[model samples]
Target chain A: MSLIESTATELLGQLQSGRTTAVEIAAACLKQIDRHDAKIKAFLRVDRDGALARAAEIDARRKAGKPVGRLGGLPVAVKDLLCTKGQRTTCGSRMLENFRPPYDATVIAKLRAADAVLIGRTNMDEFAMGGSNENSAFGLTHNPWDLTRIPGGSSGGAAASLAASMVPLSVGSDTGGSVRQPAGFCGVLGMKPTYGRVSRYGLVAFASSLDQIGPLGRSAEDIALLLEVIAGGDPLDSTSVDRPVPKYTESIARPLENLRIGLVREHFGEGLDAEVEAAVREATRVYQSLGATVSELSMPHGKYAVATYYIIAPCEASSNLARYDGAHYGHRTDEKAMAVELAAQRKALQQTGDSRKLEALDNPLIRMYRRTRAEGFGAEVKRRIMIGTYALSAGYYDAYYLKALKVRRLIRQDYDRAFEQVDLIAGPVAPTPAFEIGEKVDDPLAMYLLDLYTASANLAGIAGMSIPCGLSTGGLPIGLQLQAPPFEEERLLRAAHMFQQATDWHTRRPELS
Target chain B: MSISREEVEKVSLLGRLLLGPGELEKMTSQMGQILDYMHLLSEVDTENVEPMAHALDLTNVLRDDTPGVSLPRDEALAAAPHRDDECFLVPAVLGDP
Candidate 1:
C-alpha cells in the first residue's frame, strides 16, 4: 500500500523500524494531495514546505539518536477552525479568509510538541454552522466514496482528507456532530471527546458549551493515539477541566467482555434509514456475540434533542459571532462609503419628512456594522445570526433561549439515566449514509436533522464516536455511533477497538480515482 | 409562530446584518419555518427544570490573579482589517464626530 494509505499506527511502526523516513511519508502524502485534492476539495491550505521541514527535522533527530516525541513524523491535517500560528485559519468563512492567528491553539501546540507534521488546513462549513460541506464559503468538499455527494460537515474536509488518503490522521472540532458525522459519511473513525477534555483555547467559537476538539482517522487505535496527545487541560481555556490525562493508546487493547451496550430506543425510529438501522443493529449483535450484552434503553427526552439544539446552538452562535463587526479584525466594510450612503439616506428621509426612517439611519457606526456583517456572512450564516438574535431578543428570551436550556438539561438528564443501565450507547451516527452535495442545502431543517443522532452527546457533555458499520444499498458507507458518559473516552475507545478487531468494516476504503 | 418580514428585518438589524430584499423574504419564511418547528419544545412541560447553561456543572474557574505573557501588540493587530499602531480604526460612533 502507498504511504498515504497506511494508517497512522502502521506509519509509526514503519518510522520506528527505520524502514521508512518521515520525509518519504510527508512527500507521499503531499503527492496524494496534489494528485487527488482537485476533485476532493478537501484542503483549504496545504503546508508543503512546512510539512517537509518538520519531517526532515524528525528524520535528523532519529539519525542523531535523539529522543523524538510519540507522534514524530506523522503528517496530520487540521480543520481550519483550529488556529495555527502564522497559518491562515479561516474557519471556512470569507470573514477570516486572510486571517492568520498570532499563536497556535493549545491542541496545535500539543501536536507540534508531539513532533507531528502539520500538513494542511482543511475546509469546513462557514463558522462551523452547516452539516453539509456545501455550506463552506470556499467550496463544498465531495465525498471520496461518491464524488457527487457531500462528505458531511462542518468537518467535511477533515473527513474527506482522511477518506481520500491525503492524510493518515486529521484533527477536527465537533460542535453538534461536525467531526463524527463527516467521519461517518467518509467511512472512518471519528471521536468527539467529552466536552472540555480537549482544550478549546484557539478553536474559533461556534457554540462554546457544545464544542470539543477530537480526532479523525482510519482506525480506532489511531483515533486513540491522536486523542492521547491532544486531550488534556489547558490553563488558557477556562472551560478545559483540570484532570489527569488517561493513557488512551495504552488502554485500546483491553478486552470488552461483559460490556453493557445501550441501543437507544429512539434512534431506530421513524426517520432512520432502514440500511443504517440494520447496520447499527448488526453492530449491536456483534457486540452481543463478543460476550457483551445489548438492551433497549429509553431516553425519553431524546426526541427533543434536535429541537433543543437548534434553539440553544443558534442562541450561543449569535453571542459568539457578535465580535465580527468590522472593528477588531476580519472583514471590514468600506466605512467611508457606508458613512456617505447613510448620510444620503438620512438626507433623503429628512427631505421626505419621514422622521422614523431618519432616526433609524442616524447611526453611521451601526450602518457600517450591518453592511460589514451582511457582506462578510453567507446566506445560512445570516439566517442563523438573525434566528439567534430573535431567540435572545428582549421579548423572547424566556420563551426561546431559556426554554431550550431547560430542555437541554432534560436531554442531559435522560442520557445520565440511560447510562445507569448501560456502559455505552450504540446507534446510527446519522439518519442515512452520505447524501448528494446539494441535497439539503435549501432546507435548513433537513440539514439540522442530520445532527439529530450526534448533537445530544454534545448537549450532555459526553464522549461519542463513529465507526464504519456497513454500506448502504447504493454502496455508500454507513457509521455506527458509540456514546459514553462524560470523561469516559477510554471505555468508548475500548469498545470501538474491540469492534474493529472483529470486523473489517473500518479497513474498507473508498475506491478513489 | 409566523415570523413576519418586519420581524426578520428587526432581527437582522439586531444581528448587525443588512439583508437585501430577496434575502429578507427568504429569511422571513425560513425563520418562520424554524420557529414553527421549535414550537415542539412547548409541548414538554418544564415547569421547574433548571436551565443548563453549561453541560458540566462548573463554577466560575479562576486562576490566581497573576500576570503572564500576553500576545505581542504587533502580532495581535496583524490580522486587523483596519488598524493603526495602537488601536483598531472604526467609523465615527457619533453623527457629529
Candidate 2:
C-alpha cells in the first residue's frame, strides 16, 4: 500500500521497525495533501515545513537511541477548533479568522508529548454550528467519494482528510453529531468519547456541556490508538470528569462474549434511507453470526432527540459564543468608523433632547460589539445565536431552554434504561449518505434534521461512534452507529473493533483525484 | 406557531447581532419554522421531570490556593484586533472619547 493510504497503526509499526522514516511518512502525507487538497478542501492550513521539521526531530531521536512517544512522528490532522500554540485556531468562523492562540489545547499538548505531528488544521462549520460544513466561513469541504456531495460536518474536513488519503488520523470535536456524522459520510471511523472523557481545556467552546473532542480515522483501532493518548482528566477543564482512561489498544481485540446489541425500533422506521437501514440491519446480523445476541430496544425518547438538541445546543452556544465581542481578541470593528457613526448618533439624539436615548446612542462600545459580531459571524451562526438568545431570554426561558433540559434528562434516562437490557445500541449514523452540496444549505430545518440520528448521544452525554458498514448504489458510504452508556469507551471501541474484524467496509478508500 | 418580525428584532438586539433588513425578513420566517418544529418537544409531558444541565454529575474541581502563571500580557494581546503594548483597546464605554 502507498504510504499515504496506510493507517496510523500500520505507519507506526513501520516507523518502529525502522522500515520507514517519519520524514518519509510526513512527506508522503503532505504530497498527497498538495495533490488533492484543492479538490477536497479538507484542510484550511497545511503546515508542510512545520510537519517535516517535527518529523525530522523525531527521526533524530530514534537514530540517537532515545525514547520516542506513542505516536512516534505519525502525522495527524487537527480540526481548526483545537488551539495550537502560536498557530491560528479560527474555529471555521470569520469571527476568529485572524486569531492566533498563544497556548496549545490540552489534547494538542498530549499529542505533542506522544510525538504526533499536527500536520494541518482541517475545516469545520463556523464554531461547529451546522451539521454540514457548508456553514464554514472558509469554504465547503467536498466528499472524496463524489466531489458534488458534502462530507457531513462540522468535522467534515477531518473525516475527508482521512478519506482522501491526506492523513491516516485526525481529531475533531463532537457537539450534536459533528464527529460521527462526518465520519459516516466520509466512510471512516469516528468516536465521540463519553462526555468529559477528554479535557476541553483549549477546545474552542460551542455548547460547553455537550462538546467533547473526538478521534476520526480509517479504522476502530486507529480511533482507539489516538483516543488513548488524548483521553483523561485535566485540572484546566473543570467539567472534565476525573476518571481512569483504559488502555484501549491493549484489549481492543477481545470481543464481548455473548454480547447484547440493541437496535432502536424508531431508527429503522421513518426518514432513514432504505440503503442505510439495510446496511445497519446487516451489521446486526453480522454481530448475531459472531455469537452475539441481538434484540430490539426501544429508546422511547429517541424521537425527541433533535428537538432537545436544537434547544439545548443553541442555548449553550449563545452563552459560549458571547465571549467573541472583539474586546480581548478575534475580529474587531474599525474604531475610526465606529467613532464617526457614534458621533452622528449622539448628535441626532442630543438635537431631539432625549438624554436617555442619547445615553444609549453615544455608547460606541455597545455599537462596536453589535457591528463586530454582525459582520464577523455568518448566516447560520447568526441564526443560531438569535434563536438561542430568544430561547434563553426572560419569558421564553422556561418554555424553551428549561423544557429542553427536562427532555434531555428524559433522553439520558432512555439510554440508562436501554443499557440495562443491552451492552450497546446500534443504528444508522445518519438518515442517508451524504447529500449533494448546496442541497440543504438554504434549508435550515432540513439541515437540522441531519442531526436526527446522531444528536441524542450528545444530549445524553453518552459514548457514540460511526464505522463504515456499507456503500450506497451511487458509491456513497453508509455508516453503522453504535452508542454506549457514559464512560464505557472500552466497550464501545471493542464493539466497533469486532465489526471491523468481521467486515472490510472500512478498508475501502475513496477514488480521490 | 409563528414568531413575529418584531420578536425576532428583539432577539437580534439580545444576541448583539445587528441584522439588516434582508436578513431580518429571512431570519423571522426561519426562526419561526425552527421554533414551530421545536414545538414537538411539548408533546412529551415533562411536568415532573427534572432539568439536566450537564451530562456528568461531577462537582466543582478545586485546587489549593496557589499563585501560578497565567497567559503573558504580550501573548494575550498578540491577537487582539486593536491593542497597545500593554492593554487591549476598546471604544469608550460611556460616550465619545
Candidate 3:
C-alpha cells in the first residue's frame, strides 16, 4: 500500500520495524493533501513546514533509541474546532479566520505528546451548528465517493480526508452525529464515546452536554488505537470522567461471544432508505450467524430523539456561544465602519423621539455585539440561535427547553431499558447515504431529520459508532450503527470489529480520481 | 406553534444578533418551520419525568485555591480584535453620559 493509504496500526508497525521513517509518512500525507485537497476542499489550512519538522524530531528520537510515544510516527488530521497554539483554528468560520489560540486543546496536546505529526486543521461547519458542511463560512467539502455530493458535516472535511486517504487517522467532535454520520457517509469508522469519556477542554463548544470528541479511521484497529490516546479524564475539562480507559486496542481482537443485539423498530420504518435498512438488517444477520441473538426492540421515545436534540442542543449552544461577542477574541465589528452606521442609527432614533427606541437601540456596544455576530455567523447558526433564544426565553421556557429536557430523560430511560435486554443496540447510522449537496440546504427541518437515528446516542450519552455495512446501488456507502450503554465503548468497538471481520465493507474505499 | 416575526426579532435581540432587512423574513419563516417540527415534543407525556440537563451526575469540581502559572498576557491577548497593552477594548457600555 502507498504510505498515505496505510492504516495507523500498519504505519506503527512499519515505523517500529524501521522500514519507514516519520518524515516519509508526514511527507506522503502532505503530498496527498496538496494533490487532492483543491477539489475536495477538506482542509482549511495545511502546516507543511511545522509537520515535517515534528516528524524529523520523531525519526531522530527513534534513531537515538529514546523512548517514543505510543502514536510515535503517525500522521493525523484534526477538526478545525480544536485549538492548536500558534496554528489558526478557524472552526470553518470567518470569525476566527485570523484568530490563533494561545494554547493547544487537551487532545492536540495529547497527540503532540504521543509524538504524532499534526498534519493540519480540517474544515467543519461554523461552530459546528449545521448538519451539512454547507453552513461552513469556508467552502463546502465534497464527498470523495462522488464529487457532486456532500461528505457530511460539520465534520465533512474530516471524514472526506479519511475516505480519500489524505490522512490515515483524523479526529472530530460529535454533537448530534457530526462525527458518526459523516463517517458513515464517507465509509470510514467514526465513533462518539459516551459524553464525558473524552475531555472537552479545547473543543469549541457547540452543545456542551452533547459534544464529545471522536476519532475517524479506516479500520476498527485504527479507531481503537486513536481512541485510547485521546480518551481519559483531564483536570482542564471538569466534565471529563475520571475513569479508567480500557486498552481498547487489545480488547477489539477478542470478539464478544453470544452478544445480544437489539434492532430499534423505529429506525427500520419510515424515511430510512430501503438500501440502508437492508444493509443494516443484513449486518444483523451477520451478527446472528456469529452466535449472537437478534431481536426487534421498540424505543417508543426514540421517535422524539431528534426533536429533543434540536431543542437541547440549540439551547446549550445559545448559552455556550455567548462568548464570541467581538470583545476579547474572534472577529470584532470594524470600529471605524460601525461608527458611521451608529451615527446614522442615532440620528434616526433622535428624530423618532421615542424613549423605548433610544433606551434599547442606542447603545454603541450593543450595536457592536449585534452586528459582529450577524456578520460573523452563518444562516444555520443564526437560525439555531434564534430558536434557542426563543426556547430559553421567558414564559416559553417551560414549553420548549424544559419540555425537551424531560423528553431527553425518557430517551435515556429507553436506552437503559434496552440494555437490560441486550448488550448493544443496532440501527442505521443515517437515514440514507450521502445525498447530493444542496438537496436539503434550503430545508432546515429536512436537514434536522438527518440525525433521526444518530442523535439519540448523544441525547442518551451512550457510546455509538458508524461502520461501513454496504454500498448503495448508486455507489454510495451505508453505515450500520451500534450503540452501547454509557461508557461501554469496549463493547461497542468489539461488536463493530467482529462485524468488520466478517464483511469486506470497511475495506471499500471511495475512488477519488 | 409558529413563532411570530415580531417574536423572532425579540429572540434575535436576546441573542445579540441583528438580521439584515431581507434576512429577517427568511429566518422568521425558517425558524417557524423548525419550531413547528420541534413541536413534536408536545406529543410525549413527560409529566413525571425529571429534566436531564447533563448525562452524567457530576458535582462541582473544586480545586485547591492557589496561584498557578497562567498564559502570558501578550499571548492571551494575541487574538483580540481590539485590545490595549493590558486590557481588551470594547465600545462604551454607558450611553452619552
Candidate 4:
C-alpha cells in the first residue's frame, strides 16, 4: 500500500524501523492532495512548503540520533477553525479571510510538540454553524465516496480528506454533530471527547458550552493515538480538566466483555433511514454475539435535543461572535464608502420628498458596524446571530434562552438516568447516510433534523464516536454511534475498537480516483 | 412564535447586522419557522429544573494572579483591518467626546 493509504499506526512502525523516511511520507500525502483535492475540495489551504520543511527537519533529527516525538513525520490536517500562529485560520468565514493568529491554539501546540507535520487547513461550515458543509464560504466539500453527495459537516472537509487518503489523521471541533456525523457520512472514525477533556482555548467559539475538539481518522486506534496527544489540561483554557491523560492506545486492545450497551429507542423511531437502522441493529447483534448484552433504553427528552441546541448554540454564538465588529480584527467596512452611500440615499429621499427616509440615515457609527457585519457573515450566520440576539434580548431571555437551558438540564437528567443502567449507548450516528449535495440546502429545518441522533451527546457533554457499520444499497456508508458518560473516552474507544475488530466495516475504504 | 419583518429588523439591529431589502423578508420567515420548531422546548415541563449554563458543572475556574506574556503588539495588530499604532481604529464613538 502507498504511504497515504497506511494508517498512522502502521506508518509509525515503518518510521521506527527506518523502512520509510518522514519526507517520503509527507511527499506521498502532498502528491495525493495535489492530485485529488481539486475534486474533493477538502482543504482550504495546503501548506506544501511548510509540511516538507518540517518533515525534512524530523528526518535530519532521526539521522542524528536525536529523540523523535510521537507522531513524528505523520501528516495531519487541521480544521480551519483552530488557530495556528502565522497561518490563515479563516473559521470558514469571510470575516477572517486573511486573518492569522499570533499564537497557536493549545491543541496545535501539542501537535507541533509531538512532531506531527501540519499538512493543510481543511474547509468547514462558516463559523461552524450549518449541519452541512454547504455553509462554507469557500465552497462545499464533496464526499470522496461519491462526488454528488455531501460529506456531512461542519467538519466535512476533515472527514473527506481522510476518506480520500490525503492525510493520515485530522483534528476537528464538534459543536453539535459536526465531527461524528461527517465521519459517519465519509466512512471513517470520529470522536468527540468529553467537554473538558480537550482544551478549547483556540477553537473559534461557536457554542462555548457544547464545543469540544476531537480527532478523525481511518481506524479507531488512529483516532485514539491523535486523541492521546491532544487531550490534557492547559492553564490557557481553565475549562480544560486537570485530570491525567489516559493511554488511549493501550486501552484499545483490551477485550470487550460483559459490556452493557443501551440501544436508544427514540433514535430508532421515525425519521431514521431503514438502511441505517438495520446496520445499527446488526452491529448490536454482533456485539451481543461477542459476549456483550444489548438492552432497549429510552431518553424521553432526547426528542428536544435539537430544539435545545438550536436555542442555546445560537444564543451563545450571538455573544461569542459579537467580537467581530470591524474594529479589532477581521473585515472592516469602508467608512468613506458608507458615507458616500448614506449621502446618496439622503439625496434620493430628499428628491422623493420623504423626510422619514432622510432622517433614518443618522448614526454613521452604528451604520458602519452593521454594514461591516452584514458584509462579513453569510446567510446562515446572520440568521443564527439574529435568533440568538432575540433569544437573549430583554423580556424574551426568560422565555427563550432560559427556557432552553432548563430543557437542556432535563436532557442531561435523562442521560444521567439512562447511564445508571447501561455502560454505553449505541445507536445510529445520523438519520441517514450521505445525501445529495444540494438536497437540504434550501430547507434549514430539514437540514437540522439530520442531526437528530447526534446532538444529544453534545448537549449532555458526554463522549461519543462514530464507526463504520455497513453500506446502504446506494453504496453509501452508514455509521454506528457509541456514546459514554462524560470523561469515559477510553471505554468509548475500546468498545468501538472491539466492534471494528469483529467486523470489516472500518477496514473498508471508498474507491476514490 | 411568528416573527415579523419589524421583529427581524429589531433583532438584526441588536445583532449589529444590516439586512438587505429582500433578505429582511427571507430572514423574517426563516426565523419564524425556526422559532416555531424551537417552541417544542416550551412543551416540556421544566418548571422545577435548574438552568444548565454548561455541560460540566464548573464554577469560577480561576488561575493564579500573575503577569504573563501577551501577544506582541505587531503580531496582535497584524490582522486588524484598520489600526493605528498601538490601537485599533474605529469610527467616531461619540460625535464630540
Q: After superposition, how far is residue A20 of candidate 4 from its true place, in Å?
A: 0.8
Alpha carbon deviation, residue A373, candidate 2 (Å): 0.4
Leading candidate by lDDT: 2
Tell me which of candidates 1 and 2 scores higher on TM-score.
Answer: 1
Question: By summed lDDT, which 10 consecutive residues of candidate 1 chain B come out lowest?
Answer: B88-97
Which segments of model 1 are wrong by more than 4 Å? B95-97
Clashes of each: 0, 0, 0, 0
What is the model-wide C-alpha lDDT for candidate 4?
Answer: 0.91
The superposed Cα distance between candidate 4 and the true structure at residue B4, in angstroms, equals 0.8
User: After TM-score superposition, what is the CA distance of residue A452 in candidate 4 from its true location, in Å?
Assistant: 0.8
What would the per-residue lDDT of candidate 1 be over residues B43-67, giving only the tens digit for each residue?
9899999999998878688889999
Docking class of 3: high
True lDDT of residue A263, candidate 4: 90
The lowest-lDDT stretch of 10 consecutive residues in candidate 3 chain A is A354-363
Candidate 4, residues A1-32: lDDT per residue as tens digits? 87988999999989989999999999999998
True contacts kept of 4: 0.90
How does residue A476 of candidate 3 score in lDDT? Answer: 97
Model 3 alpha-carbon miss at residue A156, Å: 0.9
Which tens-of-lDDT digit does each residue in A1-513 have in candidate 1?
A: 778878999999999999999999999999999999999999998999999999999999998999999898999999998888887889988888888788899999999999999999999999999888887899879999999999999999999999999999999989899999999999999999999899999999999999999999999889989999998888889889889889988989998778999898888789899999999999999898899988998888888899899988898899999999878778888877887787788778889999988667637778888888888888888878888899999999999999999999999999889989999999999998999878788899888988889999999899999999999888899999999999999998899999998999998888878
Clashes in model 1: which pairs?
none
Candidate 1, position B49, lDDT: 98
Writing each residue's lDDT as its tens digit, candidate 4 over B1-97 gives 4788988988888999999899998888889999999988878988788999898878677767998888789878878888888888777767631
Per-model lDDT: 0.90, 0.91, 0.90, 0.91
